[model samples]
Target: MIEADRISKTYARGVYALRDLSLRIDKGDFVFLTGPSGAGKSTLLRLLLRRDVPSEGQLIVGGRNLAELTPRQVQAYRRSLGFVFQDFKLLQNKTVLQNVALVPRVLGMPPSQQQRRTFQVLKWVGLQHRMSAYPLELSGGEQQRVAIARAIVNDPVIILADEPTGNLDPDLSLEIMNLFREINARGTTVVVATHDRELIRRVGRRSVTLNHGQIAELA
Candidate 1:
């Protein structure tokens, strides 16, 4: 779960990327964040992930205050999250299996356990057949599926997807949205930041909209 209170971000030029923003996402909820460019949707995600410190206010994710975590704690906090990006940030040379295996391997999971978990998520994404394929060899949707597999390999409790459907065709976008819905059904809290209104509407999830760097509406 995530809670943001009175959060604001301002740049040197006096541009406010987020202004007095506040939100609460409960466990097992699937929420869509929709906003145009410069609306601070991505900024909110970055702040939650601790990729950027907020200019003001408080953010608590999974019960840990973003402002007070030690370096080690922050690293551990991130391990509890699964993240997908607009661009599939896959390792070009790594096979799909290897890409999904990286997180568990880094955590010192036994080989058998790693293989089992990797295969399970890949199977969920319908990419178990492509385990040996490299990123370049896979289609855009396939690559994004691999990215999703990699993200959930460790069984993270929260999933943050930023523009996850931004690059795919309509059909593929729907496929990805379905996968996220399934993941949410399994109890992982899901939050996606996207601009595709049609996709969001089709998915029929709760949505929060932002404008002028502030939350303008929610439904």
Candidate 2:
């Protein structure tokens, strides 16, 4: 479970990114976080990722308070969560298999298991055939699939995606959304921060809308 209780983030000059906002996302939930530019969607996501702490109040995930976690705990916490970004942050020099396999290798999994798990996720994302190809050689949609495979390679309990489909065409965007649905169906909590209202409408899932650093609507 993820919970935010009266959290606020303030920048210099009294600028507020979030203001005493509170929310809870239960495990296995698929939620859409929607708002306009400068509406604090990214700020909330960053706080959930523990990249930034709130100026006031507590953010809790999986029964632990984020603000109180030690550095080692923070690292461990991050490893258990998946994050996908608008720009596919791929290592240009790495091949698809190598990129996805990097996580298990870093976690010290046996090399054979690393290869097996990497191959599993790549095939899950329908990228097994492109495993030997570099990021530069793939199309935008294929690159995004590679990124998704990388994110889920570790089998995280939660997935956080920020504007994941922003760069894709309508058809490709729909495909990616369906892929996320499949991931969510497998029981990973999914939080998607996006500006795509049509996607939200089609999914018909619960949505939280923020404005001027506060939640304006949630349904």
Write model 2 residue lDDT over 17-113, tens digit each, in one string. 9999999999999999999989999999999899999999999999999999999999999999988888989999999999899889999999999
Instruction: Note the Cα lDDT for every prediction shown.
Output: 0.92, 0.93
Task: Go through the candidates in order and give the C-alpha RMSD of each one to the true structure.
Answer: 0.9, 0.8
Cα error of candidate 2 at position 129, Å: 0.5
Clashing pairs in 1: none
Give each model a TM-score: 0.98, 0.98
What TM-score quantifies how close candidate 1 is to the native fold? Answer: 0.98
Q: Give, for candidate 1, the lowest lDDT window spanning 10 residues.
A: 47-56
TM-score for candidate 2: 0.98
- Model 1, 65-167: lDDT tens digits are 8989989988999999999999989999899999999999999999999999999999989998999999999999999999899888888899999999899
Worst 10 residues of 2 by lDDT: 170-179
Q: What C-alpha lDDT does candidate 2 achieve relative to the native structure?
A: 0.93
